[model samples]
Target chain A: MERNLHYLKGSFLKDRLFANNFIITLLFVLLALAPLFLSDFRTNLLGKFIAYAILALGIDLIWGYTGILSLGHGVYFGLGAYCMAMYLKLEASNGKLPDFMSWSGQKVLPWFWKPFVYAPVAIILSVLVPAILALIIGYLTFKNRIKGVYFSILTQALSIIFVVLFVGQQAYTGGTNGITNFKTIFGFPLSSSSTKVTLYYVALGFLILAFLFCRWIVQSRFGKVLIAIRDSENRARFSGYNPAIYKTFVYCISAGLAGLAGALFVPQVGIISPAEMGIVPSVEMVIWVAIGGRGTLVGAVIGAILVNSLKSMVSEGFPAAWSYFIGISFVAVVIFMPYGLAGLLNQIKRKIYTQKSVKQYSSAALNILEESGCDEYVG
Target chain B: MLDAICGRVKPAEGKIIFKGIKDVTEMSEHQIVELGIGRKFQVPSVFMGITIYENMELAAARKRSLYSTLFTKLSKEQMERIQDVLQKIGLYEKRYRTPAALSHGEKQWLEIGMLLVQQPEIMLLDEPVAGMGRKETDKTGRLLKEISEKCSVIVVEHDMEFVREYADKVTVLHEGRLLDEGNMHEIQENPKVMEVYLGRGGEGCD
Candidate 1:
């Protein structure tokens, strides 16, 4: 009887998940067709949103699932963007010094920018640089057991330091103005509408890949251990899991994903700046996860797109009141729906399904009780 | 003593010899666990977010690497072992349930079940029957007795009745110092043990 009940519960969950997957498929299809209906500018904006969605997946993996709340993801994103931008700027300069370097009176390209001239090298460095940086940071912090709000604050401080260093280095980096005026990526003119459209599809593909990657990680035993660590680090540690190692591993992966997103983001957005790596942007990245539903990969994507779209709309329509509107919405989400929008949807779905299951269970129990004639009560 | 053995606290002096190996005092908890010494926390530190089955799976002494955990599925043998432990703990029926859904006694049983899955050479359980009712306590005592047939079982418990009922060899501690080490009957009859419990004036053991 217990086995039968377990089977019933399992099948019910499978059915509900199937339905959710169907909806998600439809959503993806609509996103795929969006560029056909929208203008070039809107499509480009959507491409940027997709990049944010990818970054949001990283945040979800680290903060939502692993319980390591990093407020320095913007640093990873900026690092990746800078890598890609440096490559593009070098390519545009045709082996000469980039415009900013000449303007700042540098004789040649910086040693760091030299390797970025190769597209493959640039792409690999874009991901690896941020991943390595995150490894260093994660090693220092996790090894010391710096966690919770303290970890968040440390990440925030790292972001501040990154931004300050980048802004200060006007010669090597573009500083306040950032690296811009990109013409091509491997001879494909970025200014062309076709390139923009292609880049949009590329961003969407990466987002889908990231979503699947995160989904797989969360479903695996590794993901279970992450949730275990999140719920009780001490318990996880005693269970033979080295919490510091797992924490550092997840942090590195999260940073790598953020870097991948930023690399994709640069060509479409046409610039990479220290301002993008500021503490505020990093905090906003976290808010996207919170609003979408932390610990849910699809929710992170939805949350990023929805929040950024809303931000764009509000800022464009009412610039003066945008911050207040965003702040109030965030507060409202935190207060009224602590689990976020996706969590709210799941709760409702669970309530309805649980009601149906409860009815079925009661009828089954009644039949058992009646047949047994009070010999036993099965609940 | 359990904490020291499990490397939760350092002895500050003296070596911890385990399984004929000397000086395990500097080992981490994970290293100590790897040495086949399982310690269950007093508060029943089961992973609350995961189901009871997954908790046992995590505790199982196999393929603990990150890569293995990421790629490998539970083997038939591991699954059978988990089922066996769950059955022994009387939690097989609720194996799919999360720790939060369990009763306090059930949580204790689940934690014990977790340790059992590790197949440790020695088990140190802290307050295994602290919050349990008489029936649960009796059941746990019986379980521990049965478990002792396979390996050594050391239980740190405050319940004198429980200690008297299950313990074959009892060691009494007072102010972090060993007061007496003997059979339950001997310890109960000993003046030092009586003085430690009775505080110089009480009539007898409760």
Candidate 2:
């Protein structure tokens, strides 16, 4: 009888895992086939949203799993987008000064922008710059044990600082007007429908890879330590785990993911600006993870797509009402769905699983009572 | 005092020599933990966000460096050690559950199990049985006694009966100053302890 109960428990877990995998597979299929059914413009728009989804995954890692809220991920994303933008801008200039540089009265391309002329260099720097920035910030803050809301406020300050710095640098960074008028990437026209489709697929592919990578990370023992740090830093410290090291490492990785997202976003969107990486957009990235579900990786992806799609759709007709709509929904999500959509789904799944198991256990107990004459003991 | 030993609180004066080499006061919390000292708080503090098994796994991990933790999986022996500790603490059945699901006494045992997996040379427990009932307190006393055979356990408690029953040696403090130090019988006879702690008249605590 005990063995039978154990077998039932084993199968119950297997069933839940299977259901989760099936849902994920279905979502991936829908996303993969979206371009086939949608127009080029819509598909390109999705590619941009997918980039934001990648950024959302990073936020979920730092905020949801590790419990370190970063309100300045936009800086990382902006830096990455700017890196890619610099490369494209240089390519479009055709061995001459970029339009913004010439307009700002710069005679020659800056030494810093020279390296970005190479596609490989630009791509590497896009990811590295943000990670290094995060490393510096994380190392300083975490080592000093600055955390919780203080850390969040610091990140907000970072975003504001970056926006100011970017806007003030007219000659090198294109200033308030920002970098635009991209002609081609890798000898292919940016406006071509075929290029748009390819970039969309590329963005989708990266999203999947990033999702799987993050999923693997959170499942590992290191992931457990991350959660442990979130729960109690003192307990984790006494367990011989350095909370600072783990926090800093995860922060750097999260920043890198944001940077990668930004790199992908610029090509699809065809614009990069200081406004995009300011405090507002950074906070918006966090909302996506919150509304999707914080700790769940899949939830981050869904939340990003779901929220952005809603924004695009709602803003089309009632542009003035878009912020109000998002504001209301975010407040509602915080109050009612603290765990977000994924957490709500999980709660429902657990409810069903428990009910089913309780029924099975009762029936098994009835069989035992009948066979062993235990009914006499049951009053 | 326990916090100072664990490097949670820095000492303003004097040194805390561990194994006659390392000064715990000079180290950070994790560094102190690495130097063979494990501390349990008055409250049973376990990682409530993760499974009991994971809490054990994190403690059992030999190399606490970032790279090792990221890349390495627990060996079979480490897995066996975690299982053994879990069974010893009577939490084997609930290993997959989070600490929130455990009873108060069970959470205390799980925290002990976490320290057990680490096998530190010295275990510092501040009121290990602070909120436990008599039965649970006795059980914890027995567990600590058994654990003491492997490593030295320094426990702070106010319960005279518990101290008399379990502690090998007793030290009575009055206002952060040592009033007496001896076995239970020797302590009960001391006039200083009788006056300062037991409330005059040479009468014993109930």
Each candidate's B-chain TM-score, in sequence, is 0.93, 0.94
- DockQ, per-model, please? 0.73, 0.82
**DockQ: which candidate is best?**
2
All candidates' lDDT scores? 0.88, 0.91
Tens digits of per-residue lDDT for model 1, B91-196 = 8888777999999998888888888888889999999998899999999999999999998999898899999999989988889988899988998799877776
Candidate 2 per-residue lDDT, tens place, A171-280, comes to 99999988999999999999999999999999999999998899889988889999999998889999999999999999998999999999999988989999999999
* CA displacement after TM-score superposition, residue A201 of candidate 2 (Å): 0.6
Model 1 score (lDDT): 0.88
Q: What are the clashing pairs of model 2?
A: none
Name the docking class for model 2. Answer: high
Please list the residue runs of candidate 1 whose C-alpha ends up more than 4 Å from where it truly belongs after superposition: A359-379, B201-206
Pairs clashing within candidate 1:
none
Worst 10 residues of 1 chain A by lDDT: A370-379
Per-structure clash totals for the candidates = 0, 0
